[model samples]
Target: MTDLLDPVSPDRAESFLTDHFQGVLVRPGDRSYDEVRAVWNGMHDRKPELIARCTGAADVSVALRYAVAAGRAVTVRGGGHNVAGTAVSDGSVMIDLSLMNRVDVDAGALTARAQGGCLLRDVDSATLAHGLACPAGVVSHTGLGGLALGGGYGWLARKWGLTCDHIVAAEVVLADGSIVEATEDDHAELLWGLRGSGGNLGVVTRFTLRLRPVGPVHHRTGVFPLADAAAALALYREFAERQGPDLHAVATLKIAGQQDWIPERLRGTPALFLTATWFGESAEGPEHTAPLFATAAPDAVLTRLLSFAELQALGDHGEPHGNRYYTKSCYLTDLTEGPVGQLLDATREIASPLSAIDFEYLRGAIGDVPDEDSAFPRRDAPYICTVSAQWTDPAEDAGHRAWSRRGVERLAEWHFGGAYVNYLQDEQPGKVAEVYGSARYARLAALKRRYDPENVLSGNQNISPAAP
Candidate 1:
């Protein structure tokens, strides 16, 4: 039987939380409630009634079951980097695993078992000690659990596949409160859904990832002043097509004055920055990258070979929480003049300093993989572009959000008909259907019905169960 608590009663919610939860659960008046409710993006301002800080797999199981038994919405949090703030829900029970950050590396099997709450930095530090690395996201603080679940592709993606590709096994707590081990040999179908399923099926308690030997290498960042956005886009396309699998680059359109690397006058203008990493040795990287740099006059050329750990932290710091964030992304087929012109048109209207755009080239190990091998089906899409807009005042929310939409709207005609699910913001209920193709979406929907028929986990890019 389920326990019935008063909808407006904190004491009622706290009683069951403290009694059964092995970790801390904060409420409205609690001292740490405010801080615990905050997430990575400054945009998300949700106030859940109970914030349960889970400790282990058992703790996660208890939290989910308790939410069901108590009739409360549940939000599973890890690194809390979901740009849409799906990690926390308003007036719900937040199952936070931020404290369960443990990484175990097994050299004999060339695999690492990473806890759900472990950050990318923790995984890198642990795996790099053995000269091994796996494909992860760019941000160091991004959680391994969410990243792997969403099909992570980082600098190492060219040589190694996305984070999902390296997933050897997973320990998941199903919606019915059963612990299941998903791998290739056993429960294979569930493992297929986990890749890029975005947390719909279960809460992944642990991930066993395949690792490869990666040298302590240098990360190279180059810049070209954005005088003509069209030319920059053309050059990037040409270079990326010819660049072999060893090299990787992401083309960013920044709001000129953000970085000290650009000249004073060029500040606040649209500029192109090429950030790449050479997994082998830093000295040999420039030779391959010279072609791309030669396409335009150099604004800044700062290249140094640093340790893998140092390389990962470049241009990364803590993001302020409690700000309004609106982001949208899509996969692009090309970076031609028409698309570049559309991007520039949208750039001119961005009013917020926090507004910026990025065009991440998708190739190498990411695009080279078979489409059917994983749930991230967009293998032919060459580019992933994202518009991230942020603002402080609630009144300014409309304008910032408009800018984000306009940026993509301008390229609507050129859209590849698919998007990156992780980067999607709130939109039509069928948004996930648009991001993943209709066929793949249907397959995923059926799978969701099998694993989570009641839709207990619907916070992510949700996959609702099929009708009976």
Candidate 2:
């Protein structure tokens, strides 16, 4: 690997780049350089040699051409919200796409086209204006490019399916600085690879996503005493299995905090929380969720009608950017008693008050899609167990990370042997293959050879090109 840190005269590089580029070129000491380099995870404080703030697909091509010609490592930053912090790297040419956030909604066609740099909130706000939305992540601040490319899931997933399932077309800048549109009839293979492979083949400049009719939903959230966790989880599993496609829910285990909704005595105590949303009429939500409240006997419960956008923003307050984060996750084949016990035990050792163990219910429309339809292949799993650790103090990093790791290890026996690519924090060898399986990884590698033969876009969860 060539050292991207090798000295290149700033004036010469900037002049050459600006001559053909329509975007700003930033260097180490330039104003806004630090702001551009910062990512969602505060743990990565990398210093890139140059930052190319791209305005459009042409600007992306120029940046890629510059990186290839200079023989420098290239890192692409869309929203800079990936937990792994792969968007920016030390001693690399950072292609910053934060400036290219433009959303175009075709209400008549029920589709929306968003630029690479748009956040979940950007797409949601635009699509909701037409009373339609695409299935995406819960946090509004997360980048659309990363989440969708990694097979997005949210409240709408149970009804409409994942974000990848809604993708109709994409505009991509390939490794050779060529721009092309990937649709079912065009560069179709690339589109298949992009659905869940995490941006290894090219820089996606725009994504045209199919939208569905969505509006205010009945949202229910509640926190129960720790003693009720076992019963609550059991009831949740039963409810998830019996519920219709319109129901999307999550059950989380964590220590309660100073929220006004939590009882004063229950604050700072370990608790189990159940959150559910009904995509259909708000009036029917209570009937569907009444069983859960009856079984768990929560200490607090809040149920109301909220816009789809508001429901998406529910988790944002707890997960502010700039907090150090580490996560380990796996798909659950079954939520058996043994794994549930392990999770409860792990929660007892929480290192930070902000840390949590979350289990998302998966079924209905998500399972209706064939596994081979896209690169995302864990359709058989019933749930995804994520152990997330977050903190502000650098000194608490080791403890929190260890807690997360142990939690995953304890529950490994119940895992389906597949992991969510978006939740992956480190580049463990064989991890990609484990996530996608051998056959799908082989197909992805072949696609990589076709579109990114030299591996110019290797900064992400990379799938190397197949041997010639």
Give all TM-scores, in the order shown: 0.92, 0.96
Q: On residues 1-468, what C-alpha lDDT tens digit does candidate 1 reach at each position?
A: 324222324335445555656877688999999898898876778899788798887778777777776788888898898888899989998889889888999987899999888889989999998988777887788888888888887778777778888889999888866788999998787888788867788998888999987765645566666566567567778887776767776777766665576677777666667665566556787676667767664677667777767766664652455667789887777888888887777776778766778886777777777777778867677788888887788888888888888888888877887777777667787777776778778878887887888889888778878632
Task: Show the colliding residue pairs in model 2.
Answer: none
What would you estimate as the lDDT of candidate 2? 0.86
Error of 1 at 284 (Å): 1.1
What TM-score does model 2 achieve against the real structure?
Answer: 0.96
lDDT of each: 0.77, 0.86
Report clashes for each candidate as comma-separated counts.
7, 0
Question: Candidate 2: lDDT of 452?
Answer: 86
- Give the number of the best model, judged by lDDT: 2
- Name the best candidate (by TM-score): 2
Model 1: ten consecutive residues of lowest lDDT: 1-10
